[model samples]
Target chain A: MDRFERQHILSGFGIESQQKLQNAKVLCIGAGGLGCPILLYLAAAGVGKIGIMDGDVISLSNLNRQVLFGENDLGKPKASVAADYLRNKYSDLEIVEIPEFITTANALEIMSDFDLIIDGTDNFSTRYLVNDGCFLLKKPLVFGAIYEHEGQILVFNSAKAGGTNYRDLYPNPPAATEIPNCNETGVLGVLPGMIGVMMATEVIKVLTGYAESLENKILFFNSLNYQTYTIDFNSNPELKKLIPDTFEAFRAKDYSLSCETIPSVDWDFALSQQNSDSIIVDIREASEMPKLEREEVLYLPMSKLLKESKSLLAAGEVYLFCQSGIRSLKAVTELQKVLPGKSIYSIKGGIAAFLSKQEESNTYGN
Target chain B: METKEQKISVRAFGMIAEKIGSAQIQLIGISTIDELRESLFDQFPDLKNMKFSIAINKQLASGNAPIPADSEIALLPPFSGG
Candidate 1:
């Protein structure tokens, strides 16, 4: 009896489908929660070549959702451990362990070798990087993301015509500080299992042409309520403008850095310039808490600044901040467009980091 | 004749839900997606700084599309975790 005898016996999935799966080369980025299930299913399904890339080590905390590791696996690099586990289980399955993190410098090169890419990363910067690299490489990307109790899965840039890419769905990456990962918000242990399996299902469907693909649709599932929704997204030609058109341009881009359009100043630097000629603009909305009581701070919300562009025209060397650094970066981008050549910088980590630093230093009164 | 006020049911997910303090919200007098967003920003000011997409009746909406009466609106922020 063959190892794939059970699956091959299923209707419409025979030797041909199994052979297609065997010939398929899939690359899964991030060996954590989503990657664990995705890699497990793909390897069990007998994918010919599987590449697991992650720069993180297996920690005790990750065992709750990252099923690929155990107590003995702690302190081991996730990529190698996951690869070894899969390889030891299946001798024929070729698992490549890449212990390095994916960055713009190596994303395109590494992704170009695979037939399909899976994004299981936990940050906006890497998500965008993977999306852009897959788009450029013209490989179908199976994307999975999870929050507290909900998960989202999508298959982008497939061979199907009219297929939408990640950029079409999200033209801009959300600010890094705005969206908290499972580490911060906390996710149910089973959420990633459900989402990752869904992604692996998409990978199989795309590889074997066994079923309809989610080429332009995003499946959003909430485990808490057991409610699932599929939202259709259309390809936007304008979104391509955000991506680099050539490999040279892509190589020149910085994927590890978020919000590169504007310059950023650390909390220490921002504090040093507090009483200097640099004007401090609080871009957070009026209702947000942890207000800066300093007399030198300017309470100008982004909405007001957009409506009244002339208010900041006379202000020299403007510094922007918000709850997180994201809104402030957006403010810098907007202000730079109108006031070209002006020195505009967003305070890194925004007021949240600044307040924490103040508390640490016991300088709230100052 | 007395005019009836229009109200739309809103559902927020992930960080947007945290900011709104509830998974569900009610926006009154909002006739379009943009209006609903503005109303949400006014009620939950922190939403202005966050990035999210709006969906109406299970379809991702763009621009100032008119909101259907008693529409099921969903505010979805990006989910970065795996």
Candidate 2:
């Protein structure tokens, strides 16, 4: 019996389907966390040709979940490390590396060559980029995300075989601040380890044409309870309408080219205005992260601001904020509906950039 | 049926902690902090955490934990996302 046949029978995804996996080409975006496991499983499963794209270097922080790297690999670009790691692990597999960030400028060019795409990005901007790019190209996207203990996965644009895309679930992109990254909160090392593995499973199934792919559905996993549930999705006309009739439009209306567009404030000007007369209102939720420090700051999670704001601030100048500065804008919009003349502006980049501006203090206790 | 502010304690983490100083916050609330916070989240729905855990009077509680005015509450961020 071959190593592939661990089961009693000759069943292993079989030989013909195996050949399809051996011949298929796949592209994986991001080479950290989820990307590492995703690439590892795919190569070992014998994906004939695989393109790994990333511009990020391995950080000391990445070692926790990106098991593919070692202490000596820190600071090296992830794409470089992952490519070499995959090749060494499976010398027979065709492992290729596009040593650059996937951006709107090159989404189509980079994705057009692959049979499938696995989005391992940690932020919404990148997820949106991958969603739009894959939709435009009509390629399959193997998407995964880990937030604390939970993870979500979706297979979009499945080989022109009538699969749904990202927009099927979220019809429109919410402001970026609404979703903070692991950096702002944090991820348990084991969390991504599990989610990323499941993602690789989906990819292998799609590659071998074995088992079933999660098409037009979003799968949710609760690592705590170890339960898996899925929500059905429809091909929303809102998204199908996104399919540009020509590659020119796909390239012209570029997305995914930028790794992240952080919302930033006019810090120099805003900080100057932080005085006794003005109150800087942090509109982020209690747990929504990247907490900044300042004296003039008023800690009112957006929830509180909307409720008793009138009583709390009978008369005052209020500036709103959240993680990315996006939510602050929304809060400002909402506040205007009630207190028409109240002054409110979102802190640019919310607290992320705020802390980035301030000298690095001790990282918050985990 | 309802009274004014009662003295209580609260806990927080992640960016929330980074914003508010680290310490068991001794404060006042009418009911429970969860109730207070949920009303906040209603206006700002994005903060809904699948893993938003809480502790009431030093014991972990669900989203529905009832607060009897000024009861201590802790807003915890997800622990597994590390």
Question: Candidates' lDDT values, in order?
Answer: 0.82, 0.65
| Per-prediction TM-score, chain B alone | 0.90, 0.56
- Choose the strongest candidate by DockQ: 1
TM-score of predicted chain A against the true chain A, for each candidate: 0.72, 0.69
- By TM-score, who's the top model here? 1
For every candidate in turn, the CA RMSD to the true structure comes to 11.0, 13.6
Error of 1 at B55 (Å): 1.7
Alpha carbon lDDT at B64, candidate 2: 61
Worst window of 10 by summed lDDT in candidate 2 chain B = B73-82
Among all windows of ten consecutive residues in candidate 1 chain A, which has the lowest summed lDDT? A176-185
The sequence of per-residue lDDT tens digits that candidate 1 reaches over residues A11-78 is 99898999999999999999989999999999999999999998766767788889989889876788
Q: Pairs clashing in candidate 1? A: none
